[model samples]
Target chain A: MFRILKKSLKTGVATGRHPQATQSSEPLTPEAHKKASAFNRSLAIREVDTGSCNACEVEMNALTNPVYDAERFGIHIAASPRHADALVVTGPVTVNMARALKDVYKQTPDPKLVIALGDCAIDCGAFKGSYAVTGPVDRHIPVDVRIPGCPPRPADILKALTDIQERP
Target chain B: MAETKSCDTELKTAFPSIVQRDTTQREFSHFFVAKDLLPTIARHLHTQPGLHGRLALLWAVDNRPARNTYELHYLFTLEPSHRWVLLSTELAKDDRVFPSITPHIHAAQWYEREIRDMFGLIPQGHPDLRRLVRHEHWPQGAHPLKKDFPWDRALGRQQGEHRFHRIEGEGVFEVPVGPIHAGIIEPGHFRFSVAGEPIMQLELHHFWTHRGVEKLFEQQPLAAAVPLAERVSGDTTFGHSLAYCQAVESLRHLDVPRRGRYLRSLFLELERLHNHLGDVGAICNDTAYALPHAHCSRMKEQIMQLNDRLTGSRFLRGLNRVGGVALDLTAAQLAEIAAEIDRMEQDFSELESIIAHNASLIDRLEATGVLTERTAWDHAVVGVVGRASGLDQDLRRDRPFAAYDELSVKVVHYRYGDVRARMRVRMDEIHESMRLIREIRLRIPQGPVAVESSPRAQAGEWALSAVEGWRGEILYMVMAGDNETIQRCKVRDPSFVNWPAIQWAVIGNIIPDFPLINKSFNLSYAGNDL
Candidate 1:
């Protein structure tokens, strides 16, 4: 235990600042704060991998790492969809996972946000003409935010997510 | 390289009916055996003395319009000699059945089942012929890989039921997990027969992420297929792309520039370092040890940032091309990488000491998931999973591709085959990869990174390429079509072989410990399903 404490002390602080977008000087209107209060204070997210190559999932995982430390912003990944306020979906919707993705979306409580994370999820990027894909995430469900990149960087994901929480 | 001539003479003498085909190179040999004599000859080869033979891959190719037959290719890797032996047989169009080798060789079980599902080919006398890749929505009589079937045809959904083997007795019931898991991981269904706490049996239903990757490869030109290969499994961008490029390069006898080969090795080591670091943290995270997990995650992030700075893609995507690498590193960049590796090694050693001293962490890891060497060999497990179970096989050392022949690779093996053993294997490999990177930076010479050549091969030519990926040995078999198109490209991710071994690994372990055991293996669902 002494070694653990020593190591922790030596490592010091690891949390880094979020993207500049998160630090807006312009304050939100009173109506916007009222509308976003439920999610802006604390957001519970549930990530669903429809049929990703898993690069997006890796970036999503990095959101909670020491550098990003998304939890410090009152955003934590929930264990179940029923407890989540937002659904972060990745990958081109495969034929086998279309139904499951819908069921998970329905299970989330009302006034929820759906994020299509990655170019594959947004437009079926590299897997466009394949027989197995059922197009993008919006083909199956209504998406509110679309973050694009082969896999968007972790900071990009954090900024988009924080932007959504503020604008919701 | 050892000569396989003596073994060839013995094989001809032992089986007079088997006919050996002429080959251009000596590293591998191909043979044509009668359909009925396949199982017998395979069994004989398995038991052949002085040659440790293991069935590596089995796939069927459709040849309908050109020839009224479906050819079956059985690839076997002989240990210690690093020679590959391929046994092939043609099935006439009217008869789509071939003798199954799974009864004698346990490693051929999933391959036979997959052939049955994808090509509509029957493996005669095979046990447990269930749905391997085709999920419930896929209608019956829909074999997508058949040449007659159009690549983009959408089919109507069909209803089907998968029967799971259920155990019945007092205090025994089933626990069914997800195709959508609780965590941010990929999808796969796991059914466990449990009595209160300990698990009696575990069976998995994968292919939930199958995007018809092979069929997609057929639609694209040979040059455009590298992007598809990179996404085969996102985490293995470097490994999959490298394997696909090597397969194309070997088919045309194209050699990567001396500098390109060394850069490939350097990037491959960087990919390994990042993945191993992430996996160590994930395994620790599963065991509720947050300190090591945090530190390892930080180190992994640093490596990924380095990759992004060098290659412009965090996962090292688009770095590999047909003949060589797309990007080259300068002296200052290489020096920066070397210094970064030094700092990471120092920080990692401290984290290792902390993890090694934690009694609770060790208590959760040791003897939790035990996969014996016998079971691992039967399943043909590869990579760290095989090495942990004492298989003592490393494709980098045995086959030696991508500058591995020039650089000495230290293979790490553990006999205990537990969670701790797997973790130890990853930890040691992390250090080894760092050392390899340092050596590559010092030895890489000045030359062109790629050659300007459009690869050309005979219409029916094919080549098999294997790379020791971070997860395991990734194999790609590319068959060239007319007009430089790909007829068939069979990708064998190590997860396809190692996923089944997880069933054996989790036996007798408690239900709560499943996460730790699964994370220890850390097999890729997208790679396996593809």
Candidate 2:
């Protein structure tokens, strides 16, 4: 128990300043940056993996760790879509998961934002042209933000989440 | 390298009439059997003491235009000798029906169902021929893996409920979990038949995310297919890609450089480290212990950052090419990695001690979700789950690919196949992996990371590559096409075999302990579904 306390002290403060700082770091216009910070202050996210390779899920999960501490910014991953203010979907929308993706979109309350969170979700990425893939998330539901990487870094994911303003 | 056991002479002497041609390669033996005698040979190879064969993978290839038939391949790894024997038989396309080996082998259940779903090959005697890969909405006779099917074709959604086997009893209620879960996990439906809190049976419905990974490999050039292989399972990026690269390298007969082998092993161990750390944490999280989970996540993040610094990608993506690794590690980077691993080891040991002293955590973990050794062998479970159940197998030590041929690997196993046993196996493996990474860093050869050898299109040639990935043995079978492209690429992720074992593990466990038990195995849904 003493060792735990000592270790905790040595760890120090590991949380990062989110929304305001992450949004400001983005090369966005000041007006847009302000809008993003205002909108993302107390965001509740629901992560939906349509047909991912799971790299995106790892990075997303990291956001909650001590390093990123997404919870510090009120960016909690909700357990249900009904409570989610935003749906962060990953992977290329697969054929079998298409109905579930759409159902998740419908379950989210009106004025909810959908963020496409990988190369696969954005443009079918590495999984493109496969018969099982149903293309990008936008093909199934309207995506407000697109974070592109095979899997975007955790910091990049935070930027994408905080930079969200409205449905594009 | 290990001595080549002449499985050819032994097999030919045993079954002369059935074995048409038996050719032995460096790692495995390819045997061409008569179509009608496939089941007979499979049963014999499995049961006979001389060749105690364990069915590793069962897949079917759509051989059109050249042969006008479908070829079924049954890959088995023989015990004692540890030699692989690939038994293949061709079925005429007009009557593409073969006797199922599931009744005899038992592990061939899902594989036979998958062959029927993907290639339209009818496994005649399969006990349950429910659609495995092709979703229920897929129209009859619309097999995705056939050569004639368009790569980008889409079939509109079909309406109807697929039948799930339910237990009929008074007060036995059914609880259906999801294709879309509440947590940040992949899509897989779990239907549980429970008498109050104890689960009587658990049926899994996977392949919701099957993106035609093999079919996608068909469209790309051999070099371009590395990315697809890496994405097969996101967490297993390096392992899958390395296996794919090894398959191509073997087919081309290109010898990788010493440094390349060392680097590949280094990256593979790093991948194992991060995943095992995260898994250990996640398992604790499931048991409602947040302290160990937090520390493990912190340590995992530290490794992830180290990976990002070593390779360009955090998951070590885009680092494996055809002949060897894409990027070369500098001397300074190697030194830094050594130091980081030392620090990680210290932090990990501290966390392990904390968990060790906690009696409540032990109470929750001990004997929860016990998968007996017999059950594990019946399902042919691989990786840590198999090791925990006393199925003494580790491809790194047995097969020895990459720099593992040179380095000594300490294979960890436990007789008790419970959640605690699995956790112990992982903890031991983490220490072993750390030792390996340190050794590789110390003795890494000074040479080029890759060989300048262009892979040509070789028709009718096939190669198999098996790597001991963090989850288990990740096997890749690649066949060359007539047009300098891949004819077929069969990937058997360890999760493919381990998922069925989870059903048996959860038979007596309560509903609340399900998550803790599931996380102990931590089988990949995307890997299994694909």
Candidate 3:
């Protein structure tokens, strides 16, 4: 109790998880892609950083912040994996992460999309040809889409997910 | 860069079985060692109070002959002395048995097990030692991390695939989470056996995206390998690149210009601030606390925005080269960023206050998932997680590398070792970071950001460079080859030791709080995945 008070007094910042904020919408395009998103639209996403450089993962979290305000699109990060639809993966696939990635991918109901966000997931990028990386998506399991960048800018990722609503 | 002689002295004292001293470079020296003394030396060094940098990472480099030699590299850090000691132990093809350091350090248990399962190096005494980062059913023989391991092996014969282990019991039901999941998440699995909500055994199975960075890096020269090293952990691009660059600089006897060093420090701190902010939000979200999560994340995004405005890449990716940072902040831009950070700091201060003002938040976070000071010291964890538990092991201040000598970093250490303590440490560090950014902004040095670096590295030369990353100390050992590719490149992330402590921290906590506890650690799985 006392320590928390001391810390709060020092930094004057406590990481509280919620505030009274409602959802709003914004599209990368001037108009919505398909009137309705195919990606379990309106679904909340909880991200698992099974093993990522956080390059791609950061973008996912960025979706919620006011800049992008993915909540405006009615999308939120669910606390549990059971509530998410699109599993966004980053980093060159590492050996240790294979099983966990697969397990998460499988649990998401049939109509799910796995977005391999970043160069490492697309073709292992520069880290390819290593004895450790087994990712770049498409290798271990099926990847619906690949967002290529050493790390895609948050705007690029925002565009990629919004673009999904346009795809048949 | 030429090899230095300090490496020779270490190989001699730490591992006397070193048969050959290969010190051709003026920066660092390498030694070919006998296999017998590897574990014993590791045990000796763990107890050595002075020979610091407590074995940060333990992994093997594959020398792919018909009789493959799995070489285990243990990277250590000695406090107050910014020196890194990397010791290697090689095992023959059929003989992979080596004693585990888990008995002494407890932290090496996971690292040794990972080496065992990934590269086929066996650590005999590792308790709970099983295949980590590999599927349970992954075949025993075809270790993926070995040099001889081919990229197309899965097409030829399934090596270490679909090999996740299963727990067997009656009445105790098993719930298996995925290698993929319902979330916008990465690949990994968790097998939980529970009678009720209480989880009896939580076995985390990973290894979906194993690109084999260590072997692939060995195939390239240090100069060409810069791109691969940057991708080792995407969020840590700058951190990994800086560590690698430092190691090469150490070996080549190259000095990154003073301005270059300052820019590198700026970028590293930016990376730390960004990641720490995300974690603060993440841990709160795990507790179902929405307001703080939103605030913390917004603060994190602001940093990313600052990074984009300053460095042109939000994650600070592609901004690190061999010699120094690829992105340089101009006088105007640095000032603007410093101003922006000042604004962000104010918001951070306000948001963090709101969370701290809440009684329920502190009640849940304090004393929950406590890692006692003694256990933390014994494991020798680095960074804030360790610092939160009363271990004063900050590499920047203790070792005084780079601009750390010019700057003051009073690490805010706490003895409580709980989620609250961890968050407190993060808050303290962010304030510390805000001060740093402001100071650096005011004291911006005028010069080129990165100098041209491409020294003709010899095969025999090696160097050790250690830096304090957000998560903790990241050590790199680079052995330059004649052709410019790395003969040996080993990177040790702080998470290697910290992750195991997560298991211990989660020991008595209910499953629901696991996410909150885990988030406080905020370790990079990809950093450890390789």
DockQ of each: 0.70, 0.68, 0.35
lDDT of 1 by residue, A73-164 (tens): 88899989999988999989888889899999999997787778898999998888677889699989887667888888898788776665
Tens-place lDDT per residue, model 3, B281-359, is 7777777887667667767776777776676666676676766667666678887878878888877887777787888
What TM-score against the true fold does each predicted structure earn? 0.97, 0.96, 0.82
Residues B1-530, model 1: lDDT tens digits: 33589777777888899899987654788889999999988888776767667888998899887898999999888876768888999998699889999989999999999999889999999998888888867888888899887888785699887889889999999999999899999999999999989999999998988888999998877877999999999999999999999998888889999999999999999999999999999999998888788999988988998998888788999999999999889999999999999999989998899888888899889899999998998888999999999999998899889898899999999999999999999999999999999999888889999986665877888888999999999999998898888999999999999999999999899989999999999999999998
How is the predicted docking of candidate 3 categorized under the CAPRI scheme? Answer: acceptable
Superposed model 1: Cα runs more than 4 Å off: A17-38, B1-3
Compared with the true structure, model 2 gives a TM-score of: 0.96
- Provide backbone clash counts, one per model: 0, 0, 93
What lDDT score is found at residue B3 in candidate 3?
23
On lDDT, the stronger of 1 and 3 is 1
The CA lDDT of each predicted structure is 0.89, 0.86, 0.67
Please state the CAPRI-style docking class of candidate 2: medium
Scored by Cα lDDT, where does model 3 land? 0.67
Docking class of 1: medium
